[model samples]
Target: MKYTKDHEWLRVEGDLVVVGITEHAATALGDVVFVELPEVETMVAEGDEICVIESVKAASDILAPVDGEIVEINDKLVDNPGLVNTDPTGAAWFFKLRLDDLAVLDAFMDEDEYADMIG
Candidate 1:
């Protein structure tokens, strides 16, 4: 798994990359109330706003971490937003991205580096 400065985590699964906010991010947001996910099969570039998350604290956008097509999303989040708080790194993953080059992931931080940055 790789982590971003923005507190997003990426896990490579088969040929796709799964994306989700870290536990740190989930804690910061308080209790999530709603999640707006992107459409499957939508193409996006790095930094594009792809989803919206509303919590007790505030509403936030989930950005595309890399250039890719969104092949799948966790529809369960819409019905149970608290899943983000309960299982952020697992079932809370927002989407799966099919990238042109998975090699681009090397630019992100490792778990140790992400821990150090947050500290």
Candidate 2:
């Protein structure tokens, strides 16, 4: 998985890309109560605020890691927002993106770099 400075993570999955907030971000947010996801087919730009996660601590924007069109959102989040805290990098992913240009992902960090930067 690759990471963004804004605390979002993305990884290629066949024809699409999966997206979620980093574990550090989920932990910081406390228990998530609600998640506002972008609609399918929504066109988004790199760095755009495409989703919002509200937690006991505060609400935070989950930015698009690169330019893309949203293809799918985690419907499970509507009923189980706590998944953001319980399994952030797994089934709790916020969305899947059909990347506008895969090359745009070169701007992001690999897990090791992201870990050190956050540390």
Candidate 3:
């Protein structure tokens, strides 16, 4: 898993890239209550706020660490925000993007490094 200092993670699978908040992020956010996802096909730039994850404590922006077009979003999150707390890296994924620049992935932290940072 690759990560941003903001606590987002990206996983490349074939031509699509999956994005989600890291476990540390969810834990920090507390109990998530809602999520707002970008529409599919929306073009997003690196560092853009593409989604919002609202927890019982506060609302957090989900930034796009890579420039890309959103291809899919996890609708499950809208109905069950606790999924974010339960499985941040899996079922709670925010979106899948078709990246415009693969080089942006290099700017992010790797799993071990991210874990160290959060630890």
Candidate 4:
């Protein structure tokens, strides 16, 4: 898994990259109450706001970490936004993206680097 400075985690599964906020981000957001996910098959550029998450504290947007097509989204989050807090790095994944080259992930931070940045 690779991490972004924005606190998003990217995990490669087969040829797709799964995207989610880190536990740190989830905690900062307080308890999540609603989620607005992007539609599958939508094309997005890096830095685009792809999803909206509303918590007890505030509403936050999940940005696309790379250029790709959104191939899938986790519908579970819509029904249970608290999943973002309880299972952020696992079942709370926001979406799966199919990028032109998975190699682009090399530019992101490793887990150790991410931990250090958070600290």
Residue pairs that clash (backbone atoms under 3 angstroms), model 2 = none
* Candidate 2 lDDT by residue in tens digits, 1-119: 88988888888898799999889989889999999989999999877988888998888888887778899999999899999989999989999999756777777899999999899
What tens digits encode model 3's per-residue C-alpha lDDT throughout 37-100? 9999999988898899899999889998888899998999999999999999888899999976
For every candidate in turn, the CA RMSD to the true structure comes to: 0.5, 0.9, 1.1, 0.4
TM-score of 2: 0.95
lDDT of 2: 0.89
Q: Using Cα atoms with residue i matched to residue i, what is each candidate's TM-score against the true structure?
A: 0.99, 0.95, 0.94, 0.99
Question: For residues 9-108, could you state the per-residue lDDT of candidate 4 as single tens digits?
Answer: 9999999999999999999999999999999999999999999999998999999999999999999999999999999999999999999999999999
Number of the top candidate by lDDT? 4
- Backbone clashes in candidate 3 total 0
Per-residue alpha-carbon lDDT of candidate 1 for residues 1-119, written as tens digits (9 for 90 to 100):
99998899999999999999999999999999999999999999999999999999899999999999999999999999999999999999999999999999999999999999999
Candidate 2 vs candidate 3: the TM-score winner is 2
Ordered list by lDDT, greatest first: 4, 1, 3, 2
Task: Between candidates 3 and 4, name the one with more favorable lDDT.
Answer: 4
Stretches > 4 Å off in candidate 2: none
CA-lDDT, candidates in order: 0.97, 0.89, 0.89, 0.98
Q: Model 1 Cα displacement at 19 (Å)?
A: 0.3
Model 2: weakest 10-residue lDDT segment is 99-108
The superposed Cα distance between candidate 1 and the true structure at residue 12, in angstroms, equals: 0.2
